[model samples]
Target: MIRILLVLILLLTPYHPNSITGSKDKLENQISTILSRIPSNTKTGILIYNPLTQDTIYSHNIFSPMIPASVTKVFTTATALSLMGKDYRFSTILFTDDSNIKDGTINGNLFLKGFGNATFSSEDLLHFIFKLKNLGIKEITGNIVGDDSYFDNIYYREDWIPDESANVKLPPISALVLDRNKTVSKRKRGRRTIYITENFKNPPLNIAQKFKQLIEENDISVNGVAKSGITPDNVLEIAESSVAITDLIAMINKHSDNFIAECLFKSIGAFYSGKQSNSFYSQQAIQEFIKKNNIYSINTEIVDGSGISRFDQVTVASVNGVLETMYFDLKNFESFYNSLSYAGVDGTLRNRLTDLPNGFSFRGKTGTLNSVIALTGYLMSDDKDELIITIMFEFSKGSWNFYRDIQDEIIKSLAELKKESSDF
Candidate 1:
């Protein structure tokens, strides 16, 4: 009878070749094999977590500080959404000192005040013009002044590479950005046509100039030239153009737009302090957010919103912390999640991971610099389990493609994981 009982007990136990331990071991071995190919001096940090189970699936140098390139947008966007809310909007207002109009003329200067609307464009200016025409004002007797005092005068971060100044991605940061602070002009030389692209040294002044030209083109007249100055407190508001924070974050995350990212960063500082926004206040705001949420306990430095600054440093653990926190915040999670690029579908990842297995998907942000590459986001499997993964490689001496291949492989391996089975 005892022998019969023992045989029944043995038969009742289920066999799991892909048990938790076995599957975890397999994954670790696969990741280790991939890491072995990296150069000796390279810094690597990776962390994978199952949010539903609150289990850390894997970690490697997770707390080591590494340079994060464009991945910095993840933190910036998350913080902005948490504090500013999805309905927040940046406004550009037009004001005039003279409320009294005689025969469709303004007796005083017209002020174009910017509150760091990075999407402010010529179309918005046209709308302003239309509004002015409807107000029955065809001429301005005073100067068209540009007000950019919402943020500080510093245009570029000190740590940005000077050689990359001409890159469209590195356009000058300003409160009054027009067409993303880029100016393109056509030039003719030796019977051949060439185009010259340049960044505006003074974005506010350029905007004022463009506004003046547009006014003239629309059959209005300006007696004075375009100039930069402060908007008076007593001016009467004429018109306004605004963009929601939701759209701005999409540009920051999906396309990795540096200009918009920086604008939003400064806006965060301005929003909290009600003072002129600068790097000092902006960095303080981010640090306060980190402390309030207990995001990480490791050493990290955030020098700028866009990861273009060489001084920016973060760990995979910190990155994952932000991801997990945003995931649980019910109010803002949807906006935050939708801002990320979808793998194999849209945004920066449109051309990447196109061959992912059926029902496997990744929605995340990609960061890249000369020798740095990072990816962090949510990875969903066929079984409906969601995993947050962060992979960062800094100061690599090998080709970036090599490290990217390793990242893709790790993602593929994790995506193949089954919720109840260890088939991957």
Candidate 2:
């Protein structure tokens, strides 16, 4: 008992209470001053961590649960990396439950089942056909039945810009989908062509050439017109340059590709824990993951992984909860961080931090929809301390100035804090 008391005394002796108190005061003052500086009516929130004082510099509105837009990709990508190993590859398989085979002339229709294989590429597709060929399956006699039953048919978020949604590229979600929900159209320029088929039954280019010839036979010469089209029900042949989801995501973050973002969402369900490979089970899985991980509470309702939904809502506490979960998983932590666009290098941060303070911070993901804007991810101070920051804005009409200025104010303040810490 006496020895314990002695140890406690020694532990307390060197502890500087005033120093700790001073640090708190400094951090609190900094946060308050920064919050006060924001000019807009943006419903904004923030979180900061100071390693020196072991403080979780934080703000409450951070969990205001605003629309995230494509920023929802952050959740999806993170979920994918967590559930499906980073190295896990999605495979597109071709198989039929029949015994008809005769030099590419079978009596039954060909079947194509898609499992949201985001990685499905021309090469992978070719490989699948080769596998089919190896099975002595040469011809399909029946029409292609694209098996998209793997997922529930819940495409399109509750809130989407109608004008943007109408574009076929931004088509509603579907199982057994292909190519950013679009198809390639090719036309021939040379004359002497004939026979064009609207069904695209075979040799599309040849058929296109034939069409041009017919047009010429009609005494009309037009060859340079590119054909406009949607992807075929069954990918008859693989291409050498069709972009896959990996590249899409690469561009998705870099250029903020909304089309690619939505197309890839279906891939999540098809890849894992889905009733059917093409089902939109991603949201359920995410909720379960959140519940199982005990990070966010069960109340967080996520419509689309992307925050394009106006009905989506998350709490500040839950946001922190998710962040806390991320802090421990190092591999996931790294992947999560790396996946975000670098301030100037890529991702949503392209024009953001080019000449700004937080620009040079670690990296982050940005979300925007109509009147909503948000920023989240890691930030580092000059002292080498890493902080997780989540900023969300829900500003009213004529709140643009306030929305931007407030975020900038918050960013500038963090920059100053970083600078101040480095001075020591």
Top of the candidates by lDDT: 1
- Model 1 CA lDDT for position 232: 89
Local accuracy of candidate 2 as per-residue lDDT tens digits, 1-424 = 4324544555575666676456556766866776675545656666655323335665665545556555565666666666765565443444444454545454543445544543343445444555555655544444433444554455554333333342223444554444334335556658644443232222223223333333334333332432322334444432122334344455555556654555555667666664553323766666766786676553466555555656556655556555556555655665555667777566556656555554247476676767777666666654355566677766666454456555656665666655655321
lDDT of 1 by residue, 26-92 (tens): 7898889888988889888999897655678899999888888889888888888888888899999
Q: Least lDDT summed over 10 consecutive residues: which range in candidate 1?
A: 159-168
Q: Which ten residues in a row have the lowest lDDT in candidate 2?
A: 199-208
